[model samples]
Target: MKYNKTYIFGITLVATLGGLLFGYDTAVISGAEKSIEAYLIRPLGLNSLIHGATVSSALIGCVAGGMLSGLFSNRFGRKKTLLISAILFFLSALGSGFPETLFFTKGEPSIGLLLAFNLYRIIGGVGVGLASAVSPMYISEISPAGIRGRLVSFNQFAIIFGMLVVYFVNWSIAYGQTIEWINDIGWRYMFASEAIPAALFGILLFMVPETPRYLVLSNRDEKARTVLTRINADRLRAESILFEIKQSIGRVTERSSIYSYGKVVIFIGILLSVFQQFVGINVALYYAPRIFESMGAAKDASMLQTIIMGFVNVIFTVVAILTVDKWGRKPLLITGSIGMAIGMFAISWLAYNEIIGISTLVFIIIYTASFMMSWGPICWVLISEIFPNKIRGQAVAIAVTAQWAANYLISSTYPAMMEYSGALTYGFYGLMALLSALFVWKMVPETKGKSLEEIERLWKK
Candidate 1:
């Protein structure tokens, strides 16, 4: 079958925009942390609990969004649902950025005001959640089987790119500013910057066609044929592709227990999702600045270091994209898990002994690099590819919801945990990393270059 490079690249870009939004939303909060703590906790007199809740509000939305994306995408078409997610992203950015002004902030501790801000963050979180589940799914469905892993990996690449961009934006905004100036206005600008990408995402959504699987599922055969033709570039192959989708849909519907698959698949998917988070990658990404601060760097220096971490993340994600097909998924997971465990153990020892110098930074960079090349991008690629078409949407949704919930738990608890046991936290994550390696060794199969049908057959057998 002849491949249309232009169509593939265009669709990949649209789907990957969700990654951009994900990266922007996730990392944008880092810059706002100091200002948010100052205004709400220090000056406004809110306690640590409330301040922490406020900070992690977006994650709550992420869980809810991920939980619902499967249902929404199944009911609406993927393209429409993505457009709806874009709307949510735009609103969340605006609401989160100017919460006090958008809603009614009477003075200091207004319950309504707090809830309002959190609600906005949740709205954006939902967008992230939907994108997380669907973007790769969309990419997977549309891509040629031979190149599916590499193309779907573009989603993770976009996410890391987004993270890197925001880090640079954050650093530039706070570059020469004093603590007072940063606390006063700089953070708000950081949150507001999300609006640019959010708008871009919305515009791009219109330019892409709906997934052919989705159109076929909805019985819009002509539209599905058209999409398949444009995407696949051969009438005969397009019809065959459409027929395959129909067969999958028919098999799924014939089962009286389609919903039960969600239960079993969701359990596995959620565990994989949760384990990924519990491994504590975000603790490194989200709190890099604070972690550097703990290592005796000034705020500006710490922010600069966080940017460096982002750069490392981007570079290694490229490495993963190149090698994921060549090396296969299982080996990457095993290698990453081992590397992460070792890196974490070393960092824990450094922090535990108060080895305050360049060595500590070097180790953290190694840890981040290890993650980007393996679990960071490859996990999403595997999840996107491994599930059967019958339960792919629902299963992936469950996994993503579990991931966000785990992310919230890890992010929210980290501060207090650090206060109580700094080195112990790293030790705990290192242990999890070792366990992750064992899990992969025992359960994960190599899915490189296999079609979805082939993967499903191998798993069922």
Candidate 2:
């Protein structure tokens, strides 16, 4: 059947905006973290633990958001849940930028003010959690099997693009500013910048239809058929596809049994989410500037290096988007795992030898690029595809919540871990990379070119 390419991509673009905001809110901290450390923690004589917690406070919200996503997406439908997330993003950006609105004076460094800032960030994290889980699910549901991998992969592309944009935005805000000015005001602007995209995402979300699979779940068959017809561009094909979805979904209330597909699918989904974070990708993302600065680059140069890394990420992620359907998921994931291992192990050796130079930078790019090509996007794809319709919502929430919790543990502990030993820290991630390769090779089933119903049957088998 001929799919409506224009209609498919048009709504896909809207769905991906959720992904863009997820990246924007998550990475915006990269630029503002040091200033947060300087302004919020230092004056209070807080240690690195507090500093790390303050920086990673959003992950706490992410866990909550992830935990809640299944319920919200199930109840509200994917499009409306994303709309909710966009609203949260907007409020978080403004509040995080001017947390004093919560009634604490700026520069006071009171515990209350710190709490307020983290609160706003957590609110945003919830948005990221919802978007992260629902965006890919939405894309996967609406996409045709032939192009689903590529379309769902675009969510990852949007995410990386958003991070890159924020990295550039942050850099622009601080390019000519003095340290005092940056610490005092530049960080606020960096955070406030997110509101623009957040607003855009919220506004555009209204233009897209809810996923047909979701409409089926809601018992809105006519609406589902209408959406499917537009997306498939073949009335008969759409009807057939709709029937297949109903057969797979089989009474939405009855399908929600989390273990209805058996324990293996859930376990694999959880493993994918956990391994993604354990490889220390978030460390590179959240602390790029600090890592570069520690390697002796000036502040501006560190930010510039981050932009370069972001560029590489964009390029490699595009490679993944183009090849995910062609190369297949397992090949890409296993290959990426090996590449990431090599990158991290090399960085570990460099740190062990106290070697700080261009090599360290090269390896960091290699590590992030390897991730961008593989686990970064593939993990989300698998989670969105692996479960049966009977259990997708709760299962995705469980997987994603586990993911954010793992992210919190890894990211929040990095500072103390660094203090103990940077070499060991990186070496540990390298070990995870190797293990991830083994896991994918041994367990993960490839879903390339398979319809969501076909995947549900595969899991049932």
Candidate whose TM-score is highest: 2
> How many clashing pairs per prediction, in order?
0, 1
Highest-lDDT candidate: 2
Off by over 4 Å in 2: 104-107, 251-255
> What would you estimate as the lDDT of candidate 2?
0.93
Candidate 1 per-residue lDDT over residues 1-461, each given as its tens digit: 48898989899998899988998898887777867787656666677667667778889989998989889888996887788888888888888777777655643535666677788888899999999888988988888887887888889999999999999888989988888778767877788888888898999898899888778777898998999898888999888888877876777676635353345444555666776888789888777787898899988889988988888888998999898888888898888888888888998898889888888889888788888898888888877877777777777787898899999998888888888787899988889888888877877677888767677666456
The count of backbone overlaps in candidate 2 is: 1
TM-score versus the correct structure, for each prediction: 0.95, 0.99
Cα-based lDDT for every prediction: 0.82, 0.93
Give stretches of model 1 more than 4 Å off: 105-112, 256-266
